[model samples]
Target: MSAQHFVFLLVKNHTHLTLACATEPLRIANMISGQELYRWSYASEDGVSATASNGSVTLVQHGFGALPPCERLFVIPGLGMTDFITAPLLACLRRAKAGGVAVGALCSGAWILAEAGFLDGMKAAIHWEYHDAFAERFPDVALVRSVFVADERHITASGGTATADLMLHLIEQDHGYDLSIAVSDMMVYAGAREATGEQRISLQSRHGMRNPHVARAIAIMRGALEEPVPPGSIAEDLGISVRQLERLFGRYFNTSPSRYYMELRLDRARNLLLQTEMSVSEIAVACGFQSLGHFARLYRKHFGGPPSSQRGRIA
Candidate 1:
């Protein structure tokens, strides 16, 4: 079979780690198979170099308008993705889709695909950090918590090593399981997860121990962030008393149930503040704060500054 061609459009501030993870698997596959299984190139908004978020610069072979025909085009964007979405880039993507080229995204590049209207009514996987804002902004898109989504014409990975997983899945589909395993073994990546694998660690693993009551209560808290359920309500849902909930929180988290819930809401508010273009007041309301003044005071007390001070900070 002919080699599959892939083009990576690296927007400014793109994550460097994800780019390496995406392309390295292909290179290793080719080396292992003793064949040119895949060919790849780079592009940028400008016809020159694209600088990554970590200050590395990649000299690209094409600009957006001059992108070469390829089997797939993967957009690699990172923090401040909104600032990099432009008319030329969107037009290029639209043209590619119109021409029947498969499109995909790495990291926060799902934002670009969503902005270009490629993800409407399609399931996608974006970096877990973008989950809150991406859902709020693009209600039409069905966002899954998986590492990658490949069932549709347009593919997306949650970034980081997830891109590598997606590439391995493609390799397995195009070649065979043996070649994919060879490539993975060569990379020393033993824990490469499948598409249905979730992006974030489970609450149980994160805490290093399992407690069903704590887990259930935290799940309730997370689900009701926008209209936070009271600790008593969460306890009732778990069929436990409020005192038991408080004792659980104090034992496992070293905090009270109310404080734990407040911290959860504030952390989400912080994520929205840094990740989205939402105003502080809008974020406060979205995070279940009815009084802007009260929210600001609590935010300052928790984070050592007001919510407005968090604007433009890198996530």
Candidate 2:
């Protein structure tokens, strides 16, 4: 078999720590093996360079326009993907797929893959904050909320240590536990988890709301995505009046029910913009906004950009 060539599809201002966690284990595995089982190059839309969110510059040798065939391609991205899917990068990923590269995403990179239209109907994982919004955006893609999901081959992982876990899983798959163990020992990763590991918290428990009505209402809202009911309708279903719903939201969130729901819808819009290559009109409809102009207006008010600009930034 040929030596595995791993390539990273990075964007400007990707998270530096994630880049390291994604690549270093492979470097270590090569060191421990005394032979090159994996080799990699960095790629971006252009052949220029990228700065991590923390302000580190990484030089890129290849533009997506000139990338070589590779066994795997991983996209590493940082914040603001909700507004940054550039067409050039999206096309690059699409071309890579047409060339038969196995692709994966990390950190906010899942948003990029979704933007490339690569993650539809697949199960994936991503950072926790974007989970609700991601689900709302890509109804076809199942957001697993795991640290990593390997079965779909559209593998993704939450950032930080989860990035390390993903690289470890790759090492294990290619080189076996001996090399994975050596690299893990070198990295002092006794606490590292496998690809099949679940995310740390349950959704209900994370909310810390013992109040059954609020919990049930959240579930109802989550279920009724295509036809979102107002908090009043949800309240009625929960056996509470709208005034009672207002009190519950105020007590727990310090916000009114209407504002909270709006936030939820807009948040979903943001995720759809980042993760799927769907057009602005498509995303708007998916987020339950009947009017494209209204969706764009609310998106700007909340996230400070129109849908077109947001998608451009992620690329």
Candidate 3:
């Protein structure tokens, strides 16, 4: 079979994990199959290098001014994605689509594709962290909460290991199940996750709480992490008395509503500390803790270290 060429357009601060997961599958497939089944290259805006969120850099072989024809062109973006979606980037994607190339996005790369109008009127997936903002920005795009979306013309993955799932699906589509499985085994990947798999764990799965009211309450808390609603207000919204809500929480979670809310916010703060470059104070405010001193105390108690220390370890 002829090699199916894939070109990845790397934007500044692209997620390193997503880029590796997207390309490594193809490389392993070729090794396992003993054929040049896939060919890939990287591109940037001006033939320069692109840096990832983790501070690593990738050198590009092509620029938007000289995009190579390929079976697919993926826009791989990460932090500050809005700043990278310049007019030239959008035009390059548009031109690729017009020239009959399949256009795709990995992670926040969907933001650029949507800006280029490629995802308009189509179902798409992006990194869960960007979902709320992406939905607000691209109202015309039907955003799904899946790990990835493989629509007829537009392909998208929610980033991270989900990019591997998308690539395995494509391998299965092109070759067969056995070869895809072989490639997955070679990479020690736990088989292929369906495109329909969710990017975020459901509340019930996360907390093992099954009661309907408890589930609804937890969902509300997650949605309002930055500005938590009072427990009484949550009970009121659910048309239940505060006592009933408290009983439900104690029954399922064995904790008070306010405590549970604090845990949720703390969990989010921990993730931001590890995965993003947000300052401790900024993360505290974003996670609904107004007092920096108070936030530091709670964070140390919960995570066994200060938020700044966690960020330092990650760095």
Candidate 4:
């Protein structure tokens, strides 16, 4: 069979782990199969080279102006992805999609796809840290909690090792389960997660949060970040007394339920502040604060800086 080709557009500050995870699977597939099952190439926005977040540099085989033909074109982006969403990049992607190339994204690259209008009404996944801001910015896109989404024409992985999982899924589809499993064995990637596997650990498992009621309460708190529910209401929903909820919070967080809820909202506010272009006042309102002054004061107290000071995007 003919080799399936893949092209990756590497934006600056892209995470090296996901990039490696994306390509290494293909390499292993070829090694195990003893044939060129897959071919891959790299491109950069400038047609020169791009630097990863960890300071490693990668020279590219092409640039946007000269992207080679491929079966799949994946955008591999990292921090500050919004800044790199330029006309040229979007146009290149649009042309590829228009010409029937399957476009995909890795890591926060889904943000780029959303910006280019590729993921509207599509099931997509992105790195969990960017969920709140991404949801706020692109309401039309249906973002799933899964590590990857593969059934759509525009594929996406939530980054990190999830890229490997997506690649393995493709290998299994094109070749067979045996070759994919061999590739995984060759790479020591046992038990790669399926497409529907969640990106985060259950709240009940992480950070010693063993109490189911507390976990349920935290889930409600996260969902209501934009319009926080009252502690009494959360307790009632959990079928427990308000004082019982407070005790649970004290046991796990050593704080009042209200204080823990405040921290959750502040954390969301911080994510929006750093990952989005939303103004402090808008973020304040988005995080359920009625008064900008109050938001700023609490933000400063919780984060050791005013919301404005958190303006810079992640690098």
Candidate 5:
């Protein structure tokens, strides 16, 4: 069989991580197979270099108006995506679709596809942070929270490592499980995540609660990580008594609302510690801890180490 051609249509401020993940699988697949199983190139609307979200620039090999015929074309975009979608780019995608070229998107690039009317009546996936806004803007599209959605013609994946998952899925489809596994091993990837996996933890799973009110209350807490509301206020907002809320928490989670909230904040602090360059005190303040001493004490009690020590280990 001939090599499958792919063109990644990049936009300004494209997500560098997603782009790398999406393309690395193909490169690995080719190396493992010792064949040009997949060929890809970067393209831009005006044949210019595109700047990534991290300020990295990618030189384009093709302009949208002068793209080489390809089996698949993927739209990969990043932050400020709403400002990047233009008539010419949408027209190019629409024209490609009309010519029977399979189209896909990574990250918020699905927003451009939806604007082009290709995702109408289709189940699409975008990064979870944009779920509410995308749903509100594209009411006709079925915006799912899965890591990626592989519809008949339009494929969409949420950003980050989800792009890798989608690309691995496609590799398996095009070649076989053995080749896909070989490529994954070469990349040091543990395993490919299923496309149906959720982008975020469900409230029920996070809090181990079945009661709708309790789940809703926890969701509220998650939404207000930096500015926590009181448990009494949470109960009032949920139209339940504070005693009832406490009872629900005690029955299901075996913890009080205050304790659960503190755990959630600590979990966020741990993630920031491992993933970001923010200082311990900044993380404490960001997680809504008023006193750094109290934050350190509770953090050690919860995580079995001081925040400073945790940062040291992570760094």
Candidate 6:
């Protein structure tokens, strides 16, 4: 079989270590085998040298202006992608997609790609810290906070070690298990994980409320974020008085139930703004607001801007 090939896209303020974690495995795999199992080159926008978040810079072999044909093009943008989404970059991505270049992303690069209209209707895994914003802005794109995604032609992943895992999966796919294991052993990785390993913190523990009643109430509230139930109703359904409900929230979270519910709605709204392409009116309606004016006012009061403006700046 021919050697697997890739083109890695780097950007300013990228996580340099993550880049090494991703590409070094391929190098090790090639070293282990007697043939060229993998080959790759680095590329950047405008063909300029790319810098990492930690102040290191690397000169690439070619710029996005004149990329070499490769099996895959993995975009590895990091912080400040909100500023990185330019007409030229987006046009380059569009051209690449049109030219049949299989595309992928890492870290906030997913945000950049979606802004360039590459991720519509596709399920993506992105850095969890950006999930709220990503999901909020790109509702059409299914957002899974996992290590990586490889179900179809695209292969986006979250941050840091997730990049390593994605590369290991690629190695395993190109070579067999033995070569993959050898490469993994060369790096001293504990072991290769199945693709579904956890990417973000699990919800079962975030609640910290072992009381089933409180858990049920919180879950219900999360599910019904748009049309929030009155805290009193929640207490009543949980077979507790309003005072008791207040005591539970106070004990567990040091806050009021109404406040908790309000925060949850706003949080959901924030995510919609950053991740989905839904209009502000649509997001407000989905989050349970009947009055667009009221939703905009409240959103401004909570997040320092109206929903539309926030999504515009971020997405």
Error in Å for residue 72 of model 2 = 0.7
> Candidate 3's residue-wise lDDT over 1-315, tens digit each?
799999999998889999999999999999988999999999988888888989998888998878987999999988878777787788888899889999999998888888877778999998877764565568899998999999647999989999999999999999999988988998888746898988888778887756789888888998899999999999999999999999998988799999999998998887777655667888898889999999999999998988888773222
Q: Could you give me the TM-score of model 1 versus the true structure?
A: 0.94
The sequence of per-residue lDDT tens digits that candidate 1 reaches over residues 43-124 is 9988799999999999999999988889999999997788889999999899889988999998988889999888999999
Could you give candidate 5's per-residue lDDT for residues 1-315 as a string of tens digits?
899999999988899999999889999999999999999999987898888989999999988887889999999988878778888788889889989999999998888999888888999999876764575468899888899998547999998999999989999999999998888888899857898998887778876656899889888998788899999999999999999999988988889999999998888887667545567888888889989999999999999989887662221
Local error of candidate 6 at 197, Å? 3.1
What TM-score do all the candidates reach, one by one?
0.94, 0.68, 0.74, 0.94, 0.70, 0.75
Error of 6 at 170 (Å): 1.9
Q: Model 4, 131-222: lDDT tens per residue?
A: 98899999999999999999998999999999999999999999999999999999988979999999988776677666889989988998
Off by over 4 Å in 5: 202-246, 250-315
| Candidate 2 lDDT over residue span 121-175, tens digit each | 8888988767755665666888876788877867788887899998888889887
What is the RMSD, in Å, between candidate 2 and the native fold over all Cα? 5.9
lDDT of each: 0.92, 0.80, 0.87, 0.92, 0.87, 0.79
Error of 2 at 40 (Å): 1.2
The digit string of per-residue lDDT tens for model 6 on 143-245 reads 8767888885677888788888888888787667888888888889975666687785545577654777677788789868868888878988999898988
State which candidate, 2 or 6, has the greater lDDT. Answer: 2
- In candidate 5, list every pair of residues with a backbone clash: none
